[model samples]
Target: MSKVVFITGASSGIGKSIGLYLHGKNYKVYGTSRNPSKVNVPFSMVALDVTQKESIKRAIGEVIGIEGKIDVLINNAGKGITGPIEDTPTEEMKFNFDTNFFGVIDVIKEVLPSMRLEKSGLIINTTSIAGYMGLPFRGVYSASKGALELVTEALSMEVKSFGVRVVNVAPGDFATNIAAGRYHTPVFENSAYKEKYAENLALMDSHVSSGEDPMMMAKAIYEIIKSKSPKIHYKVGGFMEKFSIILKRVLPDKIYEKLLMNHYKL
Candidate 1:
């Protein structure tokens, strides 16, 4: 029998690509989105809002009703928040974490019972490269992803005995709508760091617009799923991102910051 997969945030970008890629591979994929009507894929699409417990639970129930078992759960739906921490409001931070961090938690919680009962499953949480290396103007988004990294690590250990595996996929600047469509926070009328905010926005826009293709990430996900034993973390992107990870490990803190500031002209 073909493996069954559940993927969230399938309306567009990486989530959508994963759904299409897996479906082509003959997997029974149930794609979830806030608006299932907007998803163009032919796979079974379900409406889900990861931030809401009831929505996630209902979506999982719908999938289970048909598939009977979930072989893989891909937590790929997430948004981006860009701005200085000092300039960002407390409420905005809460909202960002609510979607990016707690939202994933809710999805995992709802699906755990099924996986536990079956005693076999794979959970792939879409973390960001920001989770590994902190970037300017993305403090809150980084915080959320960093939280996910920790959670995935703990989850890997906790679920190991159950024959369930948890892994984190951290992709660097990819050609996706995340930096554009996924970035939004209530702006204040007047702020001291308005100029800095503008600069950072322009910087982020440039990087993502000119980044690696999202399909590359889809291929990475496929490889991990095909692997017999996947690692706790998988980094996908261009050669520069791989080198950046190494540089961040070996270079001095000041040097790394200097390199980033210079590269982005910040």
Candidate 2:
């Protein structure tokens, strides 16, 4: 039997691409959106709001009911939040963590019981290259995804003996509809960061508009599933985007900060 794969936030964007690609490859793919009925895709679509625990439980139960077990769990559901740290609302940051961090944990916990019982499973987290660094105007998003990356590392060790594997796949920007959905603190007129924040926001949108294809992520994910011993972390993106993570590791704190500031034209 094909492995059962469950993905969150699959209505569109990277999540959609991963789901479609896996379905085409004969994996039993079940993806979730807040309202799955609205989206037409080859894979099964279920309703799941990551921000709601009950929704997560119901979605996982529905999949387990049909498949008996979820061989792979992909935590791709996430929210994007961007603005200067001072200008962005604290509540919005917490909300982002709820979706990008807490929600992911909830989904993983719901699936672990079945996975542990089966003594075999894979959990792949869809984090961001941005998660590796604090990018301008996107600090909250970075924090949320970065936290997930750390959790993936810790969870991998905890579940190793159970025969369940965990990994993080951090993707660079991809052409997607994320910009339209993310919370953007209004460009307050009198605020100190008015001009720069407005400029950076547009730049951010353009980067996504011109980003790499989401199918690349799908293909990378497919390869991981086929591997017998996949690494703890897999990065899928352009050379420079992937290299930036390396640079962060090697460079001094101030120098790295300077490089990012220059890139953002701050």
Candidate 3:
């Protein structure tokens, strides 16, 4: 039997591309959205709001009923929040964490039992390069992804003995419909960072709009899935973005900060 793959946030963007690509590769792919009815993809669709525990359980149950076991689980559901950290409201930050961090945890908890029983599974998380370096106006979004990356790292060790592998795929800018889902925190008229926030937000959006094709990410994901033993982290994107990860690790603290400030024109 072919491997069964379940992916979240598949109504559009990178998740949708991954689903379609995997389907073409003969995997029995199951994709999820909060509202599956609106998803017109060729693979199976499940209604899953990753932030809701009941929704996660129901969706996983439906898949298990048909496939009996989930060979791969891709936690791709996430949202973006942009604003100066001080200006970002508490509720907005919570919402970002809800979707990007807690949501991933919810689905992983639901699917782990079956994976543990089988003594084998692959859990791939879609993190971001922004997670490594806190971008100027996207602090919360970066925090969310960074937290997920840490969780993925720790999970790899915790589940290793159970025969489950966890990996984080951190992508730089990618062309997707994420702009629509991104929430811009309200900037008060008297805020100190208002003007700089606006300029930085615009620059970030432009980078996303002109990002590399989503297919590159989808292809990278496929290779990881097909590997006999995949690494714990995979970085995918343009040269500078990929190199930034290495630079951040090796560069002096003040020098790296200067490079980041210069890149964002801060």
Q: What is the lDDT of residue 114 in candidate 2?
A: 99
The count of backbone overlaps in candidate 2 is: 0
Candidate 3 lDDT by residue in tens digits, 1-266: 89999999988989999999999999999999988898798999999998889999999999999989999999999999999888888998998999999999989999999999999999999999989987788889999999999999999999999999999999999999797689997666899987788778788889899999998989999999999989998999999999998999999999999998998788
- Badly placed stretches (over 4 Å) of model 3 are none
Candidate with more favorable, higher lDDT: 2 or 3: 2
- Give lDDT per model, in order: 0.88, 0.95, 0.93
Which is the leading candidate under lDDT? 2
lDDT of 1 by residue, 1-266 (tens): 99999999988889988899899999899899888986678788999998899998889998898889899999999988887788777887898899999999989988888999999999999998888877777878888999999999999999899899999999888878887665544345687767767776877888898988888888999999999999999899888887888899999999999998887566
Best by TM-score: 2
Q: Output candidate 3 Cα RMSD.
A: 0.9
Q: What are the TM-scores, per candidate, against the unseen true structure?
A: 0.95, 0.99, 0.98
Q: Quick one: RMSD of model 1?
A: 1.6
Question: Model 1 lDDT vs. the true structure?
Answer: 0.88
